[model samples]
Target: MSKIDFLVIESDAARAESVVAALQFLGYHPQRGEECLVAEESTHAWRAVYVGGVADAAEAERQFALLGAAAAQVPLLAAADSPWAARLGAAGSPFAQRMATIAFPLRYEALAEAMRGLYARLLGSRRGELRFVGESAPMARVNALIRQVAPFDSSVLVLGESGTGKEMVARTIHECSPRRDKPFVAINCGAIPAELLESELFGHEKGAFTGAISARKGRFELAEGGTLFLDEIGDMSLPMQVKLLRVLQERVFERVGGTRSQRCDVRIIAATHRNLEQAIAEGRFREDLYYRLSVFPLELPALRERLDDLPVLIDEFNQRLARRGLSCVRFGASALQALAGYPWPGNVRELSNLVERLAILYPQGEVRAADLPEKYRGQPQPEETRGAALLAMMDARAPAAAVAPAPAPAHDATLLPEGGIDLKDHLADIEVGLIRQALDATGGVVAHAAKLLRMQRTTLVEKLRKYGMQGSLAA
Candidate 1:
């Protein structure tokens, strides 16, 4: 009885405009940004769906198959032009209908007629809700990988840039794996000091070291029958690598001060921003260890590379932030456009911090260019380090007759005085907004959401803690 949110993925502009309008007219809440968008702002379940701008018939069928595999129980549709007809039309009286050929301008009347028929069938379908959002390619891959790897126990290596969501990848794998019911232990291989890491991975007996006043169960032992995540594994020292390798090969390790070996069945999920191959070549990391950990490698894409997912990411961020009582956090079109142009070198973590800062400083509402950092306001991208002459040449020349319009009036500084806000506080607010936004955009699809906001999921998480908004923004 209620309206369903339809994710309309179009390959080109023509299909996007027409399909979205038709969906709207059919009483559906449609999300029409990024063509590669995977899910909605908060979930993986898909309601009624449609695809536009498909290159050809074969491609249309392939796309539909993919949707069927990923969307749980939702109906999928594609635009039907007159030449192609509705080749994949559903038969009988169906509540939801998929239109493979969408109506376009060539023969407006014919297209409209086809769309109306499809809409009528769609409205009769029973399926109504879905979850998991964002449209990033890496996310789709990750989703597929989760389904495949979760049922088995394979060492997973998550490799990516900083703020790219490696930990989230590890978590997703663990959640979907056979050990989902068991513990999911996470330890930062780089965060702990070299002296302590050895003992942390392999439990220490009483009086093992200065703090070993009592016997302790290390992470590996604690994660028995579950998963043990080693974040920033590339940072572990040579000696530690040897110790970890021994455990992986033999599946047994002795405590720091005890000679007795302990056997644990915990699966290892290691992640790092650095390249292990490079580290091995430099003699910093062991080749054998790298191979052992990287048997199933999943490389996450950076936020800059997946610009098509920005809108869904924003929606995902808003949903998570609302959970934390930051209900009014929102974004406007121009602001998002500004975000798309900026180079998010700091990645998703940087974006999360910026969002948190916005939630703290700006009112709960659409963020503007003025509210963003100076670096994003108009700063050149790292790739644009070349001369401005090239940029100028790329700009189209305006006709003399249509001379420029008058500039808008200057902004009044008194409304939110820059001088009054503490610089640290301001920065913190930005961080909070960015983190909150990233988490929400992916429907708590932490990794994809993190990429959308140009941050690593862990980095965003740390900022969430710093801004004291972690619990509030739980996925």
Candidate 2:
């Protein structure tokens, strides 16, 4: 009656009632159904689905197929005694990796445990889906590696360029892993000073150093039962590498001043822009430490290498900006072509920044090739130049046609005034004036005003809210 938290699909009326009772006992509201026929809206409302009393594995598979995308969005819980549950629980089974199988006749403890696991997994899946944006071959491989290695506690070494989103990849792995509910502590080894780096990683006891007035837990202790992301790890000093190697080997560490050794239960996920293998060869990084951290090395391809994913990445960035109440920007064909040709030396992070910058510059507007920063606009295509030249020649040979004089250049100021005005305020005033004029011309009809201004009605509504003009304007 109140929003359904769990949807139980069981053909057997007695088994369905039993599952519903168990769910209610666990403080969950559940609705029982004979088959998987959840409405589209209900799919989002429900937390998980329980499939039980299936005649055989074939029936279960058929039910699963019937569930469709809902199966991917929500966690699936199956009766352990069911014929398909055995196969579903098997290693490498796609369903087994995501679905939680609870033993029946559904003991409270087992059901609770299964629910807890599925809830954490649901959150992790959502996070992973949102952050991992690209579908390019390189990203597909990277995602596959994350899925394969996340379940295990093997140390992960993510290697990439400075802005290639190595940390994001590490976080995705941690989110997809069993430890998603735990703290994901991160520290940049390269950012901190060498002297302070050891203290930062291992912490210190009271009076360990001049600044240590109180005892503190290090990243190893703080990230217990979770993930500890050590970013830019290749820059760690040789001394620190030896200490880290010892911890990796022994799984124990002592505070900077304390004698008691603390056991670390943290999963190590280290990322670096530098080449650690080269660092090892150069005697900067220890070979043993490198070997320990590189147990499962993952290489992230640079943004330039995955050019096909640029549009998707840009769209993802625009969506993020929109969430922040910023107007989204649309890139034109020429702009996209220019972006594709340009080599993104700064990678995804740079693109994200660029998108935000464009949102601010051209809010709710289309961005042309000329609107882009000079560096990002690559040279014009030779074919385009040739076509233009041919058109010009043809025009010269044809009959002379009187062309109207070009309109005056917009905002024709050639120099800044000695006491410069607030350019943003000036632009805002101009925009407000134009919007008011559009509204007046359209008899205060917002839809007509938006059409006149060549913008979406929603975008215009947002502008009205932003400028506090909604009450003054008619619908």
Candidate 3:
């Protein structure tokens, strides 16, 4: 395996050495530099970047933008004073969108935690092209289908709600298939006008229509030896569906205003959020075309259905925000629980948007339940008793004007007990306690509990097996 590397842009001698030493201890090779030139020298080797030692907010902003351009998609972490973070937050510079800011004098443990999370996020994004991140039963079924069908050249119909990442599923299929090296062209069938959809799908001859001054290759020709993704296929008009069905059947199509048929050596992956079966029953969609498209069907569950993947999804969104130069944010326990309990009607897309919004608004704050919008702050129906307890606590407290919210707890320096304790055993016990709480809160649903603890289902399962706690939850 290749060694992981990091770019350290710091001018503070002691601080720079401290950061480098910590990175080395974590098994990552840290390359140090005073400017952004280091980014250009070893781009691919650096998995992440650390920005420090700026004179003020203005200098930090200018240097961040320069490094951002050099490092493109790599995640960045900045160590700065609280005043600097506050300045950046108020000024609303681009750095607030792309870098995770760690205030000065923080414990090494906190820094390590932040670095690990950022690195994992970057690694996951790099791996996302080939794998979809989820371990729930629904996702497992989808993976199984992909494994079974990827070797064959068959029409795949992917059905899911909008914002459920239909295009990602299509891309995953293409990556898993035999034609992985070839071009994968995607077009939204519903986005284009019905009048021009044909010319877009099938190449247009020179002077084919009013605007056809030059010949052009359509999605099919562009896809050549790989896969063609027809998104929102259910919204495709009947005439266009007929044309597509004929192409699927004959394995060839003629350019618009041209007579000669062109061979199509492309795999078809069509996705739609609409109910095509109902459309067929209503006579709006062709039954023959439905048969042709659904040779193999895959359905992706909505965000609510697969809530177990929320933690990973949030991490993925944070990585995207970091690429844009935003500070990473964390969800408090109450906030995370609230998020998990809420019904995500807009699916993964909505969740991503919300995370990005938080990154922009809060920048570097820990989000609490109260920090969320009104609609999302309320507890779900199943947690009514917990909500009642919270209400009771509120009522028991002093007047609102006399009360103040508690400050976040600070990480204390490591201390040894006079009566020595087994550090490993103590940590193991804490982990067990947290896992038990998660399991109880999730009603012993291992996958849900795994999400609650921000752990992969398989990892949780292994722990459960080791502890002989598998009987606690029915798989």
Candidate 4:
């Protein structure tokens, strides 16, 4: 996960410095002018170009033309008030139509926000081709470990909760290894019955067993010179574990009911969400087998632990659904916040399922917080306070006319003359401002912020979603 590299084409030195500083602060690496024009960075690049009104229109056109097709696909953010903005927006140019614009005067925070929005959009477009989408520190460390371990033929034990992408890691290892061209086979040891497990792992000769009318090749024989992934190895019976351990120790196994011993040239990658050490202590799994399988161990982080990566996961799922002919759906601001706050017990697989469901049900529509399933629409509360929280939420929804008004602002009554205002927008802005202030004051703790706002936690959570301010609370 290198920071996305952006090219700034501002001819004004001060403006260029400002843009570069803003991008740098937002975790992007910024390059300037001629240095960024290289085609290598353009071909396999996460390159975005920002055109902030170069002093000369000819220089601006030249810079824009140099990027070629990259400018049309990669994110292009221009200042709306720039001298050449209208020309860039002119008809018959696909690049201009696709470009996003920030209003001029270049307010630092505004510029940063615009860049952040653009970055997320760019990520959506690029996520389809990625084998994995996380850029979180946890995933980054996992990727580094994968690169380090892929070249070796030693056994690897992947440990993680179900749906945490353990098999995906194993596949990545195989793809990166020298054995990539050979067969990569997978078997779930727990999914098959104990009686059939041995026969499934090692082939039987013709007429070797009760149902063996023909010779059959098992997983190890099928995999040959490549990799074999044994998932849920922790659930394997002790008898089978002993036999598997023998194969690992001797690299050979006699097929069930067959006398001849066969050599295996396969590399092993085992995965289980169960605690094999506990199983070993209980005499359900062999210590020798555990030691042999865990020659190298890797742990995958749960989705909740890396909530920051949800956006990218959503993007990846969106792309997958689109390829299947489902209409694409986008998450509204509040929907994203709601998703970020959920404790994903089933991890990435669960997230993908939800995204797929949304794509099917609401195809092409923006998913708001209210549109999410009830379980995912709000943060889960503790059982003890659930009743009280529900009561408070019910109380907070009394009719507007029935509710008491707050005290007037503590200012001079005649300080200024006021005309009628759009009361709805004015009050909505005030509510959003106060909610943000309370969240910041509480150090991003939603419970404390809700208390500060004199509302039930659930009520406050609803308002946060209503005003698209859930991100301010940080769940």
C-alpha local distance difference test of each model: 0.63, 0.75, 0.72, 0.73
Task: Give lDDT tens digits, candidate 2, residues 79-178.
Answer: 8776666776688776665687776565654576567556545444554453566899998898888888988999999999989998788878878788
* Model 2 pairs in collision: none
- TM per candidate comes to 0.53, 0.57, 0.58, 0.56
Runs in model 2 lying further than 4 Å from the true structure: 1-130, 381-475
Estimate the Cα RMSD of every predicted model relative to the unseen true structure: 23.0, 14.4, 18.7, 19.5
* Residue pairs with backbone atoms closer than 3 Å in model 3 (clashes): 96-326, 97-325, 97-326, 98-325, 98-326, 99-325
The best candidate by lDDT is 2
- Give the Å shift of residue 152 in candidate 1: 1.3
lDDT of 1 by residue, 1-475 (tens): 3323566656676767776776666566666535433443344333556665655656545544444433544555555543333444546423134443544553343344344434323332321211223377867776676667667788889888998767766766665566755666789989999998988888899997887898877888868888899999999999889988999999999989999978889999899999888888899999999999988898888889877777776666654454333544555443565788877887766776667677766543456554567777674322122222222322235454444443332443225565464455445444444554455544556566566556688976665454445444546
Ranking of all candidate structures by their lDDT, best first = 2, 4, 3, 1
As a TM-score, model 3 comes out at 0.58
What is the C-alpha lDDT profile of model 3 across 1-475, one tens digit per residue? 3333577767677888888888787777776654444244224255577777765656555555444444565666777653455554344664443456776664464476466435433443432244676777888888888777877899999999989988877877776777765666789999999999999999899998999998877879878898989999988999898999999999999999899989989999999999998999999899999999899999999889988888888987886666444668777655676788888889999999899887766664456554577677664322232233333334323576655453322332145657765566445444554565566666788887777566899999998766445555755
Model 1 Cα shift for residue 447 (angstroms): 48
Name the better of 3 and 4 by TM-score.
3
lDDT of 1 at 10: 64
Off by over 4 Å in 4: 1-130, 379-475
Candidate 3 deviant stretches above 4 angstroms: 1-130, 380-475
Q: After superposition, how far is residue 155 of candidate 3 from its true place, in Å?
A: 1.0
